[model samples]
Target: MNKLFLVPLMLLPSLAFAFPIDVTKKLNGAEIVYNTTTISSNMAAINIQNVGGTAAQCRVVFVNGPENPRVRNTVVQSGSSSYVTANFNRAVIRLRITLTCNPT
Candidate 1:
């Protein structure tokens, strides 16, 4: 019926606005950095950096938002690099970060 169709149509915008882009990177012996200039409604971008001489690994987990949380990982090889530019919703989010470094 028309009412049924209308229900789905109304949800389209909200559904479309829920998901964000995933990003990843790798770096070493310095800081890995990411930046964003713009974000839409319920949307945000995440930046990651590594600042050390040894290879490093990191992960980011989002706890709250319009959509479910997600995890992103990066591995920086020795004297190399890794990084990520992630997109997410701005819904009372929490981040769980982990880092590991290899012995030089």
Candidate 2:
């Protein structure tokens, strides 16, 4: 029916915008910016930036509904940045990141 078709069409828009959760926080004199955005129907992008005068280590994990988990480790030097991507056979549901930065 027309109503059934419209239901799925309406949800398509949400999927297009359901990506790239941006997060920014200040820790130990360093500014950490992290984002997880959808790259495709089965892939997600991870980006991290360290804006300060120290080095940082980050551990990122991406979890889809019931797929295998993907984890990544990255190091961002002072006044530098990094980027990576996590792939899933399905859509991602949640993302978690842990950052360790040097003290002032």
Candidate 3:
């Protein structure tokens, strides 16, 4: 094969392997808990915790929406458990969370 062709071939694998993991959080009286796990080749899960005060509210958003980002039938509350799952083709995922206290 030509040298130029060889160079391109070598770079193909690297492209497929380029994945990223990103996360962000904000405080809202209650402590915010976040976590991620790789369940399979193209599947992963995230768990969030609301540990600040009673009646605290939490919301999650995907800055770079995943191929399939859905709530994984879980809830995270103080003294309890809550989580969400995200599935993507690439390795990089970005998300943000906001927590709020009960309105006075």
Alpha-carbon lDDT, every model: 0.47, 0.64, 0.51
| Number of the candidate with higher TM-score, 2 or 3 | 2
Q: Supply candidate 3's per-residue lDDT for 90.
A: 57
TM-score of each: 0.39, 0.62, 0.49
Model 2: lDDT equals 0.64
Query: Which is the leading candidate under TM-score?
Result: 2
Runs of candidate 1 with Cα error greater than 4 angstroms are: 1-38, 78-83, 88-104
**Model 1 TM-score?**
0.39
Candidate 3 C-alpha lDDT tens digits along 1-104: 59989999998865563335465555445565666655644455566665555534555544335444443333355655466665556554344333223311
User: Candidate 1 lDDT, tens digit per residue, 5-104?
Assistant: 8998898866554343433333333355544322444444455444555555665554343556556666765555445434444542333332333333
**Which of the two candidates, 1 or 2, achieves a greater TM-score against the reference?**
2
Model 1 worst lDDT run, 10 consecutive residues: 92-101
The window of 10 residues in a row where model 3 has the poorest summed lDDT is 95-104
Candidate 2 runs further than 4 Å off: 1-30, 93-104
Best candidate per lDDT, number? 2
